[model samples]
Target chain A: MRGVVLHAAGDVRVEERDDPRIELPTDAIIWVAAACVCGSDLWPYRGINEVTDPTPMGHEYVGVVEEVGADVRTVAPGDFVVGSFMASDGTCEICQAGYQSRCAHVEPVGRSGTQAEHARIPWADGTLVVTPGMPDADLIPSLLAASDVLGTGWFAAVAAQAGPGKTVAVVGDGAVGLLGILAARELGAERIIAMSRHEPRQALAREFGATDVVVERGDEGVERIKELTGGYGAHGVIEAVGTQEAMQQAIRSTRPGGHVGFVGVSHDVSLTGQELFYATVSLLGGPAPVRHYLPDLIDRIWSRKINPGKVFDLTLPLSDAAEGYAAMDERRAIKTLLTV
Target chain B: MRGVVLHAAGDVRVEERDDPRIELPTDAIIWVAAACVCGSDLWPYRGINEVTDPTPMGHEYVGVVEEVGADVRTVAPGDFVVGSFMASDGTCEICQAGYQSRCAHVEPVGRSGTQAEHARIPWADGTLVVTPGMPDADLIPSLLAASDVLGTGWFAAVAAQAGPGKTVAVVGDGAVGLLGILAARELGAERIIAMSRHEPRQALAREFGATDVVVERGDEGVERIKELTGGYGAHGVIEAVGTQEAMQQAIRSTRPGGHVGFVGVSHDVSLTGQELFYATVSLLGGPAPVRHYLPDLIDRIWSRKINPGKVFDLTLPLSDAAEGYAAMDERRAIKTLLTV
Candidate 1:
């Protein structure tokens, strides 16, 4: 099987690898139809996160079940499924409370590297959500997005408490941020503000339901959000960038008693207790409970009510995985979908 | 008028001060009936928070209205009232959403020194909640407690989402933390854990509805809480000490998807983003919006349903304000109630 591996900084390659097989009774083997690079993947690829050794890459995928372990009851061979980046037992108290990403037995599905010809999924029944039926070819990207980004964006919106009468501000312009604008709109937010400096990303933000766009960053971005919301700041702010600046902007852009839902993967961010205390905003963030929302996301994609797949501005054959990583890392593409 | 003044870190004196009068059309002058020393007061008294000038000392007060400016509509002379530490216009969006402490026109009511014979309260109509009627002398302390500690603890419990079937843990043994246990009980929490090492404070905690008492601090305290909650940590944790250790303990003692409501005045605490991100707990804190819960708190005190005033284990005449401060600073008293 061919899989993507990261050897070092700026070194992503597609190479032959041993195929994955069910290692547990709760596992299922799937033939990946598509996979994509994630914003988080850039952490190690850019050397921001150290790459100590060659590692399996990619955590997002939509695939057809190729085989199932004896105890895997819900999904069988020939079924199309979408699974969250993290595998959960789905029965723990945390998972039941919709925080499956932090389940007691949670495991990162990327361990087997979904960007391959075939991948093994653990806790199959709990981790994979089958679509209503076999999805059409064109709907594949949208369903694939549901495996992570769409669900993550939706979680950010929900965590931000974006709903009718709310003014929601999004602080990132990546695929997740763009999709967060869509989630906010779908959640009935009265206004959606997308903070983006790039023209292409801003255009996609608008197309995805951003009612306003602010071409600013940091303090200036927060100021613009406050100016737009009558000096009170937005009622809810989504932080999709994990840097300290983005986190501060998200926290500062929310009104007192409002919510700041951050889904960014944190990096060297330290928050002063005095500032957080005085801000008086409710904060809830972490690895989003993507598994909890997979079913609904797939339903939305299947119904064509949302087209999250539009985020895939470039696509490549699995053999040219390095090019896909370069395109996204250099901002040449919003996201790159690779056909397996 | 006479008031308590902090001349230096360890120097407190009862000194003559100018009488307070309405400085704004929205102000009301009150003849303070009672005032109490607070845990936060120790911050400056012990020099954790610098004291540059001779600062007037208390914020909690129960008093009889003396006079009101033309615009003070709700409160009038001769009425007995309880006012929050922070005065708010109550008409701003933040106040309307029940975050009066962060109102657009918020002002600290302690500016006139409530420990004095008379104090001027701004936004009188919004800040003072008139009791059902002038209560007997015995209830004065409880009413004064509602003006700050009781209301603050209530806010923290509410923020922590303490409710039926939830396991609530309180991280401080101060008046606010003790009252938080009471608040959690009132909010229907099934199990309440009070983290305190002092025998006297632990006794008071159990009386205030703490079902379990963990004497350990910091990491050990969190470990004890986890062990008590089937290793999942508590569902709600109240952080009433603003230091980094207390904050970390509170965050660490809460289960994933739980809430941490902090109300201690933050000093030099800082939280690492990666730690908080991984904790996956909802956080809401600040100077509590005490005014929002004033009415209910006052009613409870008035009806003798809760005896939060019991926290004031020592009593002193207003003239002995210095001794009151000393007793609290030396940990000789849980709280000191000064009669005017």
Candidate 2:
């Protein structure tokens, strides 16, 4: 099998790898149908996150279950499914509480890269939500998105309490941020503000239902959000970029007593206890409990209610996974789909 | 009139001052029947908060209305009333949303000094919540407690979502923290952890319904809470001390998806965006919207359902108000009451 691997910082290569097999009673091996490069993937590809060895490269996927271990019950061989980036046992107290990301028995699905011909999914019964029947070709990308980014953006919108009468702001214009605009609209938010300077992303944001676009940068960007919401700041803010600046701007763009649903993979960003206390804003976000929303998102995509997979601007064969990584890393594509 | 004034950081003196008169159309002058020194008042008296030029020092009082401006309707001359530390019009959008502390027409009851024989309350029609009638002498202290400390603590508990099947931790040993124990109990929290080392405060906490007493200090304090909570941390944390360590401890003691209700007046405390982001704790607090809780708290206090005034450990005449401040500053008193 061939998969994308990061040998060192900024070095992504397609190399031959042994095919994955179900190693545990709860594991299921799937043949990757489609995979994509995420904004988070740029963390190591840009050398910001240290990569000491050739590490597996993807977590998002829509795949066909080729084999299942003895313990797998909900899914069977040849089943079409979409799984979250984080695998959970589905029976833990945390998973019961709907925070599957913090499930007691949880592991990242990175050992057998989703950017490969074959991938191994652990805790299959809990992690993979089978699609109804076989999905149409046009719905494949959208279902692939429900695997991570779209579900994450939907969770961010829910955590931010976006609803009727709420004015929401999306801090990042990447695929997740654009999808957040769609999620906010679906959640009934009256106004959605997408912060973007890139024309293409900005255009996509409007198409996804952004009521307004603020091209300003930094603190000025916060000011634009404030102006759009009548000088009080938005009722909800979706923070998709995990940098300190983006986090601060998101916090600043929310009104007192408002909610900030942040899903950005935090790096060096931190909050000052005093400012957070004085601001009187409620902070509720982290690695989103993606599984909590997957079923609904998959249903929406399958029903053709939302086309989240439209975020993919370039598509390539699995053999060209390395090119997909470079295109997203260089900002030449919002996201790239790799067909297995 | 006579009032308590902080001449400097460590000097509080009782001196003659101008009698408060109706200064605004929304103002109402009151002849104080009783007033008390708050733990928060000790902040400036101990030099932690700058006290410049004999600042009038108190915000909690229960008194008989002596005069009312033309526009004052809800409160009239001769009515006995209890009001929040900060006066709010109570009709603005923020107030309607139950955040009176952030009301548009807000006036801190800091100028006339509640520790004085006479005080002027602004926005009288909205700020003062009248009791059913003048109460007996024994109920004065409890009613006064409802004016600030008890109400603030109740707000903290409410903000922390300390109700039904929840585990709550309170991080201050002051009067407010003690009442938070009471409030959490009243709010139906299944387990209440009081983080205090003081014997008297711990006893009071248990009496007020604390299910656990954690004597551990610093990091060990957080460890104890997590251990008691099955390693997930408290479902709710009430922050009654506005210091960096206290704030951080409160955040650390709460689990991901938990709520931290902070009522302590923040000083030099700061929070890191990264720690908060990764923790995924929602922080909701400020100068507690005490006005929002006054009606319910006053009823609870008046019915003898709860004795919140036990927080007052020392009593003195209005003339010895200076000694009350000194006693609290020296840690000789948890709270002091000044009689008229």
Using Cα atoms, each model's DockQ against the true complex is 0.88, 0.58
Please give, for residues B1-340, the per-residue lDDT of candidate 2 as tens digits. 8888888877878888888888899999998999999888888888887776778878999999999999887988889999999899988766787877767677889766889999999999878999989988888999999889999899899888999999999999899999999999999999999999999889999999998999886789999999998888898999998888898899899887789999888877766656776677778887777888888888988898989989899999988887888888777888999998
Candidate by candidate, in order, the iRMS in Å equals: 0.6, 1.9
Best by DockQ: 1
Question: What is each model's TM-score for chain A?
Answer: 0.99, 0.98
Query: So what's the TM-score on candidate 1?
Result: 0.99
Lowest lDDT sum, 10 consecutive residues, model 2 chain A, at: A270-279
List, residue by residue over B1-340, the lDDT tens digit for candidate 1: 8999998898889899999877889999999999999898898899988999999989999999989999888888999999899999999999999999999999998776888788999999989999999899989989999989999999999999999999999999999999999999999999999999999999999999999999899999999999999889999999998999999999999999999999988878899889988999999999889999998888888889999989999999999988898898888999999999
| Count of steric clashes across candidates, in order | 0, 11
True contacts kept of 1: 0.83
Candidate 1 residues A244-320, lDDT tens each? 99999999999999999999999999999999999999999998899999888887888899999999999999999
**Candidate closest to the true structure, highest TM-score:** 1
Share of native interface contacts present in candidate 2: 0.50
Off by over 4 Å in 1: none
